[model samples]
Target: MRTGILSEVEDMIVDEVPIALVYNGISHAVMMATPADLEEFALGFSLSEGIIAHAGECYGIEVENGPGGVSVELEIASAAFMALKERRRSLAGRTGCGLCGVDSLDQVCRPLPALAPARGFHAAGVRQALGAIGARQELTRLTGAAHAAAWCGMDGVLRIVREDVGRHNALDKVIGAMARGKADPHDGFLLITSRVSFEMAQKASLAGVSALVGMSAPTLAAVELAERAGMTLLAFARGDNFVCYAHPQHLAVDT
Candidate 1:
């Protein structure tokens, strides 16, 4: 056993910490998330979760460290604050339970706004996106554990990329960045380095994203939801091919 003392290696684990969402002085929700791009995370969560209509509605944000983990305080408009209070918002909202508290079919099949049809995406472009996303993943390069979500332009160019240990958080950060940058949600497709879970689909809908492509397979529930929302869903984007779950008409197919 003494010989083992001579051997040691540096290791890396993805960073995660408690992110408290405080609205207007009330402590609302606490989430376990990577401590980066948090201002974007807060704004994106607000818009996607229907807490605020847009980034403008959020007045200010402050982040600090508490006894446990990181805390994010959001100052939103009076109208948005009233709406949040009306919902009896608690820790309202995802790793496993993307659709939590759903014990009924109606809740599971809740209505989603129809997304506009997406522009066709060529196979070559899909392949390029698959290849290109990996290079943009800086955190994953360092931690080897972060997931990335990218927004690809209609021309197959990668515009925005965000990474986190949680796939959903990565998506949120991207959305927030896009919103701040005035990127058109319907003008391009979203690609994530994670499975197409139902929450991913839901958040895409919230962000007005008409298309979603993932590097992994999509779940049956995700397919069903995509079909109803009128969003194009594609997964297993690799090589020169991908699988389409809904609205295959959106893929150019010729490329």
Candidate 2:
């Protein structure tokens, strides 16, 4: 179940495995991750990064465990394949980390496609969603070393949640799950247990999520990105109080 084990003591070190994402027969990135739910990992990584428009665009996903590590073979739409080919070619996936392989400004500040206007949402719904997300993190309860990304509808019911040691990976897993389930992104808001950064904002926008709620503070760049993407950004989501960064109109809070 783990890699390194203590002989005298009885503690297990969590296993880390290298998982590669291959898009249309061409390898794109190799990342060190917990070797579980990898099929979901591959889908989440692709959907959150804008490699495919939706799960329908993803033809198939295959998982192969080998001596080197795990390889996820993803068959995507022709247009996505071409776009990936034109973009960056190689990536080294670090452990549960974000923006590890990005070495250029172009990649960091890529323009996002316009998003739909945000619909009004009840404040209580957002609060209930956050509570539900906290309750749904089974792995986090076990390991206490993972982050969770979740989806909640306007009614405040959390429908989906994914956990990973890395913040980005968690979000990616959620995105992939949504794609595989063929869920509509416009139907809900995304809640995360990590800080809001530029890449996080990028992924949220790519998923067409109307609003992003984070338990931690957001970077200036993240706020700017969310504004451009027409998504609302909320930070410091503790209890019933939060700081709204963009699109405050969507928040139906009592004066």
For TM-score, the strongest prediction is 1
* Tens digit of per-residue lDDT, candidate 2, span 64-114: 999999999999999989878766544433344346446455777766768
Local distance difference test, each candidate: 0.83, 0.82
Give Cα distance to truth, residue 36, candidate 1, Å: 0.5
Would you estimate the TM-scores of all the predictions? Answer: 0.88, 0.85
Q: List the residue pairs that clash in candidate 1.
A: none
Write candidate 1's Cα lDDT for 160-231 as tens digits: 899998898999999999998999888888999899988898889879898899889999979988988888
**Cα RMSD to the true fold for all candidates:** 3.7, 5.0
List of clashing residue pairs for candidate 2: 30-93, 31-93, 44-176
Q: Give me the candidate number with maximum lDDT.
A: 1
Off by more than 4 A, model 1: 1-6, 89-111
lDDT of 1 at 17: 93
